[model samples]
Target: MKEYPIMFTAEMVRAILDGRKTQTRRCGDRWAKVRPGDRMWVKETWCWCWKCARLNDPEWYHSHDEDDPSIQLDKCGVKYAADSNNAFETCDPMNPKTRKEEFKWQPSIFMPRWASRITLEVVGNRSERVHDISREDCIAEGCPSQDWYRVNGGPEKWFMVLWCNINGKKPGRSWADNPLVHAIEFKRVKP
Candidate 1:
């Protein structure tokens, strides 16, 4: 039952959502009891939002049996239609046929403003090295031939995925060889 002293600020909360701020402390008379204005160390691994924390809570999770229907609602205030009658049709954004003709030429890709650029480092052999570059730099460097994908709605995480065309060969002899495309799990840097 460790305790943490966390001072909640709007900007810090925003930074946490943006993946810029990694750690937070929770202050109270319980747990790691401390006086006011005192700081508590928090590990990035322990930092999670209410939703994620709840989902991962063992006691609450294993005991819960009911489904929350509100989870299906879209941001636009539309509910999924249960009937197949087509009587309550809502505009589907994915339907290309219904899209405006004028906007047909525009790509359907949705890029976010936060991670338009991401710097990736290559830490291996030069011959096998794919490339060390940022997301924005890669996009600009490759021009029209560049490929990208979007990771839609999920926990407040830094959504970024950059790909390089590695000819059918794998970069490293071992599974952990390629440092360029390594998957780094998001852990709130402790403070």
Candidate 2:
């Protein structure tokens, strides 16, 4: 199967890591290339350790020149060093003592497939209006369970917040306007 790189915001990454998100929508030119049966490497901007950076190796990194052929990548594509006892460190911007070997706040688009901890298999895809999102689909999009019970916008409200936050507040870009969106349903692929 063909593999593609997909970018997501930090918040969306958290949702997916929680095992609550299974669907996503892509717009503009990015959606045209994706299809069912294709594998997607989820990319998110974040911090990582030197080892992690070496394993991911997304082009911007070059600090670690050494390579270990024995290390293996998990299904999520993360490679753990042999001596770390399966434990590794991640870059924490909040931490002031961070070392040079750490990678911090890198953009998701630059994330390499090897460093990705998430993979998705597209099971279905369709084009629909942003306003056409249903409550069920909202859940699939990774809305919090509590929002589902809200009497007002409920799940749709959550999605609206995310959409605007990600796509920006540009005119004519909103769910209320029912703009065209490419909806993709996917299942988590074990690493």
* Predicted model with the maximum lDDT: 2
> Roughly what TM-score does model 1 have, to 2 decimal places?
0.19
The lDDT of model 1 is 0.27
Clashes of each: 8, 1
Off by over 4 Å in 1: 1-8, 31-71, 74-191
What's the residue-level lDDT of 167 in candidate 2?
Answer: 71
Residues 67-108 of candidate 2: C-alpha lDDT, one tens digit per residue: 332233312123322112223434353544435544445677
Q: Lowest-lDDT window of 10 residues in candidate 1?
A: 106-115
Model 2, which residues run further than 4 Å from truth? 51-103, 147-153, 170-172
Candidate 1 clashing pairs, residues 3+ apart or interchain: 3-32, 4-26, 5-25, 5-26, 6-25, 6-26, 6-27, 44-188
User: What TM-score quantifies how close candidate 2 is to the native fold?
Assistant: 0.71
lDDT tens readout by residue for model 1, 1-191: 22232322333333443554332222122422333333333211111122322433468656654234332232122111111121223445354543332111111122121111211221111122223333443332222221222343222111212121222233442223433332111233332
